[model samples]
Target: MAIVDKSTLLVLGPAAWILLAALLVLAAAVWRLALEGSPAQMLVAGLRALVQLAAVALVIAFLANRGAWAFAFVGLMFVVAVWTSGHRVAPSGRWWMAAVPLAAGVVPVAALMFAAGVLPFNALAIIAVVGQQIGGAMSTVTLGGRRVRDELAVRRGEVEAAVALGFQWPAARLMVGRPVAGEAVLPSIDQTRTAGLVTLPGAFVGMILGGATPLDAGLIQLLVLISLLLVNSTAAAATLWLACRGAWVREPA
Candidate 1:
């Protein structure tokens, strides 16, 4: 099968249009059944994703030739990931605290990959690996942060009681928030366990489609999944810590 040809482009063209139409229909259904504001939100998210991806494609084309520019691009991606996760979790003051968890998860693994020569010092390779790791960390951080905040709010009395029993405020909050915060990483765990059985992940499928052997694709996919586990676990733990430390505690209404 020819990988890069007119037929591939033809298929992608229709697929994109069909996806857009489906999104519109789904947005309409959501608006009619749920919040009236959701349709606009959905449309906006879709449009923004399209624009962002186009822009990234252009940027990647330019950056692929320059090692320094590629590193800078990755840095920009990290910053955006931090801002996005922070906004999703906190949406108000001190949302920047999200940077801690994102960095905590991404930096160590990235460093180790470089040191082990698993990640080549090349533009495309660095972008692909680091981008996925950053994205995974961002998702886990946001999930853990939001869950901890909600848990803290619901279990405020328990936290107070712990404080009353001489636990520090942070410790009290951690005690209340830890259980649910860990739930953020459960998806990663489940996906890793069920990868080839229940679902073929994109990385594996893409590699196979690009003519890689099944064994090679499977190995790469395993590496990606294991890397995600490390990233999400660290990020979730950090997010919980930040939440317990009152990084974005809401004021009583």
Candidate 2:
């Protein structure tokens, strides 16, 4: 079947609403049982995703054919990803700090991929690869930032003690935050390690469904996995460093 064939679109049309409803129902259950107050967030996130994805679909349809517009589109995606990640980590003014780790992770890898001819320097290819990399980096940054922030908040005494013991502020913060922040990469590590044995990622399955050879698909998936490792690790490290420097800490109440 074609990737976006009529049948697929038909399935997606209903599936979207059904999935959104299911998510809201699940969130409501959590809210009622666990008193988590997540139902409203779930509803808002679901609606936002629906609208944003619809917009992206229309935008891509128009821009994909225009080679000159590809970079602009990719840049927009990066900016949005950075903003979303930043906000996810910290809702306050420091949310923009996420841009540094995201760029640190994605830009270097994307540049190297293009320069080494691993990724074709074309609009579609760049968008596909760099978009995924940016997304992975964003996830890592969010995870790492939240982990470090929470750890520092909980272990404020430990950090203070280390500081009083002559450790610098950054070192004291890292002493308390680095270990937990490092956990941010665990998911990517597990996904990569279990790629073929436990799960076939979307890139591999999509390539095969798109008529690529299994070997080619596997190679492409491997590249994606490796790139994700680089991106996520860099993002996690950068986020941890930033957290150590108090770049994303909330003000005391």
For this target, which candidate reaches the highest TM-score against the unseen true structure?
1
TM-score of 1: 0.90
Q: What does candidate 1's lDDT look like per residue over 1-253, in tens digits?
A: 3234542323455666787879777986788677756666677777888899999999888878676677899999999998998898888767788889999999999998899888887887788889999999998988888888888989999999999999999999988898898899999999999999999898888788788999999998998899999999999998988887887755567
Q: How do all models score by TM-score?
A: 0.90, 0.87
lDDT, model 1, position 142: 85
What residue runs in model 2 are displaced by over 4 Å at the alpha carbon? 1-24, 250-253
**RMSD value for candidate 1:** 3.1
Worst 10 residues of 1 by lDDT: 1-10
- Global lDDT of each candidate: 0.86, 0.86
Clashes of 2: 0
Give the Cα-based TM-score of candidate 2 against the true structure. Answer: 0.87
